[model samples]
Target: MEPDAARDIAVTDRAFFHILQLAGFTGGTENLMKLGEMNWPDIRDLDKERLVAVYPIASFEQHGLHLPLLTDTIQLDAMVESMDGKIGDRIVCLPTQWLGYSFHHMRFGGSLTARSQTHIRMLVETVDGLIGAGFDKVLVINGHGGNSADLRVALQELKETHAETRVYGASWWGVAAPALDAIREAGPNGSGHAGETETSMMLTLRPDLVQTDRLHPDGGWPPSVYAGRVEHFRRIDEHSSRGNFGDPTVATADKGQRMLDATVNSLVEIVDDILGERL
Candidate 1:
């Protein structure tokens, strides 16, 4: 019957329709808006009022020999896609930002990073542009660790400047800690830059980009000594030749899928909370 009625029935008495409802088939197709697939008018219509817009922030950085430079972007995009049908109404995905503050990766080839200040300015401008276009609640889904501080600073400034807008930033990997832990249990330490988790994720998202033959020469500082340092840029090439930070030999597609699912679920919950408070 009606969507609300169907949902009610599903909640009170679970049935096959509950599965359909959970899958979002009950919600009209118009509700599913893919930002990349829509024009300005489409976006305006889809976002008639202020909406929660999710921006996938990633960097084109070195991820060792096995994974491509675009690994971060790929994983972030996949995470966004995984949440598509679930958060269709409450949220909308923006085109992925393929460049971020990756100064630490500058020591290696194929790494394109913007100056921290420039990256912050770009993010501020992007949020401003989104607000100008009608999105008031912006959720930044960052994939790189280096961009976190800049993003926080930029978002704080935005909040101070525009009281009506709210911006939230979270790293996909960081938010999916539970899943990452599960993956780690399947192997060992999963915190490397291009280590098991990241490699597994890339393998799941873009298997074609993975050069399994070149998976050797695990890049970066030894995990035991990698303290979270503000001046991480100085230890770049000194720590690793290829720019990777962790082990990737244990990466598996199954673990990647689990991590992706966990990340998307966590993001959806966070977005829902933000939207609920705002709405």
Candidate 2:
């Protein structure tokens, strides 16, 4: 409430850092291994070949009427943040790439996307840069379902170009499928896009962004003649008029916490696999 109090806090912070410096502790050990927060030397001094470089990518697009446009990014960021807390010193995390391949959701406002090839190229170049930086192990984590195919293409291209580099990618849900299946209350039709799974995660991570009053079930299209035997592409509007898919009414913060835990635990295991050269 007063200038003296503010000065005291600042002085205490300065003294703490001063003590750290006197004890031969550089600032790096105290913080997470986030690439964006570190200086050039800090990155250059790392054991590049041994440390995993995590590049998280998500979409900035519509998440139905109830969820925020940044829902996918927010969910993915939460997973990454949790993972960082577990194994941050062993990996360097790049800032999450917010834009993704969301052309299917273009009909809805606030959705942004890049052409498939462009998105692939962007991903390729980013990983290539990490490889150039001497990081032998790289992991790309995808958040939005729309970006899944493009990510595979990008990873394939990267492998073809840099056969020796250890570059891998996985969607958060795909990696923890069994766990999600065990925890989800919704059926197959209710866990697709902007569905119970995502809603539950949002409720756990950012309840304020979720419009509880507007939550409803949508996009449970009846199975067509080629439902499971073949795959087809359709815009979100084609299946869901409200710009969402699946049921959100079944979502709860407790389910969300379980999902979050499972996802993060799987991610940590994946990082371990990378470190062990198992994948």
Candidate 3:
């Protein structure tokens, strides 16, 4: 008989755990889980005391023609990778929430969105399930702008319902402001959708996904067209055919790497502060 297929292993292993301990994972390996690869037993045995779980929330929205629909997810995942070893024991990075409320991009092809109310309900349920699983502190790391308000509402409700567990929601852009300022080109303001900063990060994280040849055509969208109004699907498409907001021509992989590093570093600080504070 053919041998059974070997189970997929987690990117993090015993060596990774040891390194994490040296870096500052005073907590034992019980809290860490290769969730995607591990079974229920592995998760049940996790160390609750040292676990700070993170959920990366992103959207499958149109990021112009040059970037993939998974740009937000890609960026968030890269940020998580940047935190590897640094916060391994202190923080257990959960799988990315690949879909989000993106009604604004509904008119654009390939955009998937959940209504605000639906999204909030989903978030609450998801958090509740996590709490049920024994995580005391959960961080919702959001990557899309449209999901911000709903996420806040969901977090508030989750905290009220589960007083024992604390839930924090933060937008990646908001958290990485200082770093963005440092690496930004065309000023900090130009880092809007499919703009310099995001494009830069994508270039670094998934160079193969980026089509630099289409940068100029894709970067042609004007931000002024949708400055004051709610960016609904119809209005967005009216402004640009490609569904992008700012110039992506200036993006570079090197700049993206730096921005990603800065973003993760900021996340580490935030996690540290949260852990240090008395709840």
Give the number of the best model, judged by lDDT.
2
TM-score of every candidate relative to the true structure: 0.79, 0.87, 0.80
Off by over 4 Å in 3: 1-32, 217-235
Q: After superposition, how far is residue 97 of candidate 3 from its true place, in Å?
A: 1.3
Residue-wise lDDT of candidate 3 within 55-155, one digit each (tens)? 67788898888889988887877677666568887777666777688887888788988767667766766666567667778888998888888898988
Query: Which of 1 and 2 is the better model by lDDT?
Result: 2
lDDT against the true structure, per candidate, is: 0.69, 0.80, 0.71
For candidate 3, the TM-score is 0.80
lDDT of 2 by residue, 225-267 (tens): 6676777787889989898899999999999999999999999
Per-residue lDDT of candidate 1, residues 71-125 (tens digit)? 8877776677667767777777666777787887776788887777667666766
The residue pairs found clashing in candidate 3 are: 30-47, 200-256
Clashes of 2: 0
Model 2 misses residue 158 by how many Å? 0.6
